[model samples]
Target chain A: MKQRFLKAAAIILWLLIWQILAMIINKELLLPSPYITIKTLISKMSESSFYIALLYSLFRIIIGFLIAVVFAFILGVISGLSKNAEILLSPLITVIRSTPVMSFIILAIIWFSYNLAPLAVNIIMCFPPIYDNVVKGITNTDRKLLDMAKVYDIRPLKIFKGIYLGSVKPFLAAGMNTALGLAFRVAVAAEVLANPKYGIGTKLLQAKYNLETAEVFAWTFMILLLSYLFEYIFKIIIESRRYNAQTRKSDKVI
Target chain B: MLRLENLTKSYNDNYIFKDFSMVIEKNRITCLLGKSGSGKTTLLNVLSSITDEFKVKYSDFEKLRYSYIFQEPRLLEWYTVYKNLQFVLDNTHMSKQAIHEKIMDSLKMVEMEKYADYYPYQLSGGMAQRVSIARAFVKDFDVLLMDEPFKGLDPTQKEDITDRFLKMWRENRKTVIYVTHDLDEALYMAYDIHVLGEHPTKILYTSRNAYKMNDTERENERDKIWQILRSQI
Candidate 1:
């Protein structure tokens, strides 16, 4: 409770500083106060178009993220299992990691429809962290437990499920946490550049063109909120799974 | 008799075993008592076929299933005790119900039935080792290779777990190749004790310990085994 109160106070103090600065500037286009920003956000929330744009961006970004997760997992397992596969794929993964997100967005804009550009950008941006973490998890699985599995003549499928999956889960969760946030930021940036037909980024671009600084601030706030919400939900899901595993009751033998 | 004959194992040109042969009588407790680097664990690993880099010939050991209890508990940290046992027994063609009963029975033998739902991190070291022992017993194995499974426990806990292990062994009479550095452990558990020496490992002395021996005789035997182990150091 105390921590939450302190956090809220810190945010309020920052907002107060912004409000004072905006009042001193005395030009709405140059600087919108927090009050005007909030009012614009509330009005935008009441409009159906705002929801459609929000949903449009949300859906595409989530789908892109899910696709990246699958691809990363498959590639990670292959890389983990074979040195040759890891060697062959290392340069490609390195290039992806080193290249800027804007580069991918520009290339995607040229290759794909404006609607698909953000999705492509999201996938490209989100793949590396998840793939690296997955490979680390697989390679770092406890050797002793693996030897125990081998000695027992455990089936390959069982070993994969019980040992490998268990080892990979925490790494995957951490990767997904980072990737989900990056997905939102890059997807929105892509939408702005690609000019998607319906998206928060398109609305932000329109607001920017019209010099509606309050609306721009409102839309940026929405993006921040959405990113945090998704990250929190993901964290809850991973933690709840671990909690269930820890607390599950065994059957009582008579 | 199960014989491992003409075994040779090396790591980076340093041999641990060379032309080594030992006979393990079936359904009996045979303890390999040795110093730290005497290759006791390497021999156990070879017998269980956990290490394939060795040139070994086995006689009368076909169709044998081996269960290993490592020095550390080595329970899967992510799994509950029940699930750890289930992981091993699931492919044995036993019904789910049978597997459950076998797991519960083994856990009960180890006095760990109440902890079936607990993950390994939740258990004490002794409890986790007991659960590990339960895991080995729950599986279908003709031979049990123990590599100092009771090494790290407090003396009381070790004695208690050892008693429980012997009780379970008495019921099933599986062929057991027990490895330990402790002389008391060997004297208390083995039907036959072999003191092993290091450097291309070989047995220094073999003592057939009759189960009916009195405390004085057992102490005398322990003194003799200690002398052999001392000479190796």
Candidate 2:
């Protein structure tokens, strides 16, 4: 309860700073006050286009993130299990890590349709972290436990599920936690370039063109909220699975 | 019987054992007594085919199943005591009911049946090692390899675990190769004791004590074994 109060206090302090800055600027077109931004956001919620744009942007970004996560996990396992795969894939992963997001967004716009541009950018943005963390997790599994498994001649599937999954889950969760935020940011940037039919990025671009600073802040606020919500949900899922695995104990065998 | 001829194992540039040959008898506890760095675990690793840099001339031994208990308990932390035992049993063709009964029976052997629901971290060092013992026994292997499984216990816990281990071994009669650096431990556990010497890794002494000896006889035997080990040093 005390921690909750401190967190609330910290948020209010930041809002106070923003409010003061907006008052000093004294121009809604240049820097909108927090009140104007919140008012704009609440009014925008009543518009059907707001829901449509929000949902469209949310679906595309989330779908792209999930696809990247799945592919990254499979690639990580392959790279971890075989040296040849690691050698062959290292250069591609390095290039993806080194390249700028804007460069990818430009290339994606040129190479693909507007609908796929954001997804391609999000996938390229999310893959490296997930792949690297998962490979590290797999390669760093306890050798003693593995040796014990081998001595018992445990089946390959059991080894993968029992030992490998137990070891890799934390790294995967961490990677996803970091990648989710980057996915949202990159997807929004790509959508702004591609100017999709209905998306938060499209609204953001329109607001900017019209010099509606309050609308820009409102859309930015929505993106922040969406990113936080997804991260919180992902964290709950990972932690709950870990808790269940740890706390599940049966006195009688099953 | 298990036999290895001309066995050579090395890590990097250092050889722990070279051209080593030994015979392990069937259905008896053979303790390999050696100092800390004298390749006791290396020998067990070789025998279990974990590293696989050896030539074995065994009589149907390679076809038989094997289990290992390491220096630590090595129980999976994610699993409860019951599940740790069940993890190995799941590999077999036994019915689920049979596996449950077997796990219960084996847990009873180590007197850990009441704590079957406890996780590994919830257990004390001694209790965790007992669970590992139960896990090893539940596998129902023809041979069990132990690498100082009771290395860090207090005297009371050590004695209790050793007695419990021997009781389980007596009931199953599996061939066991127990490794230890302590002379008293080897005396307490082994039907045969093989003392290992360093500087090329060969057996310094071999004693066969098939029958239980009284305290006086055991003391005399300890003196004889000590002399042999001391001479090698």
Best-fitting candidate, scored by DockQ: 1
Q: What is the iRMSD of the candidate numbered 2?
A: 5.7
Which regions of candidate 2 deviate over 4 angstroms?
A245-254, B56-60, B90-92, B231-233
What CAPRI-style quality would you assign to candidate 1? medium
Residue A139, candidate 1: alpha-carbon lDDT: 91
Candidate 1 residue A254 Cα shift, in angstroms, is: 23
**TM-score of only chain B in every candidate structure:** 0.95, 0.92
The best candidate by TM-score is 1
The top-ranked prediction according to lDDT is 1
Model 1 clash pairs? none
Give per-model CA RMSD. Answer: 2.6, 2.8
- Tell me chain A's TM-score in each of the predictions: 0.94, 0.95
Q: Write the per-residue lDDT of candidate 2 for residues A1-254, one digit (tens) a residue.
A: 99999999999999999999999999999989999999999999999999999988998889988998999999999998888999999999999999989999999999999888898999989999999988988998889889888889889899888788778888999998889999889999999999989888899999999999999999999999999999999988876676455354532232
Q: B1-233 in candidate 1: lDDT tens per residue? A: 88878889999899999988888888899999898989998887777667778887654554578899999998877788889889888556778788789889999999999988877877788999999999999888999999999888999999899999999999989999999988887888999888889689987888885465898898887788777777886
Off by over 4 Å in 1: A245-254, B59-63
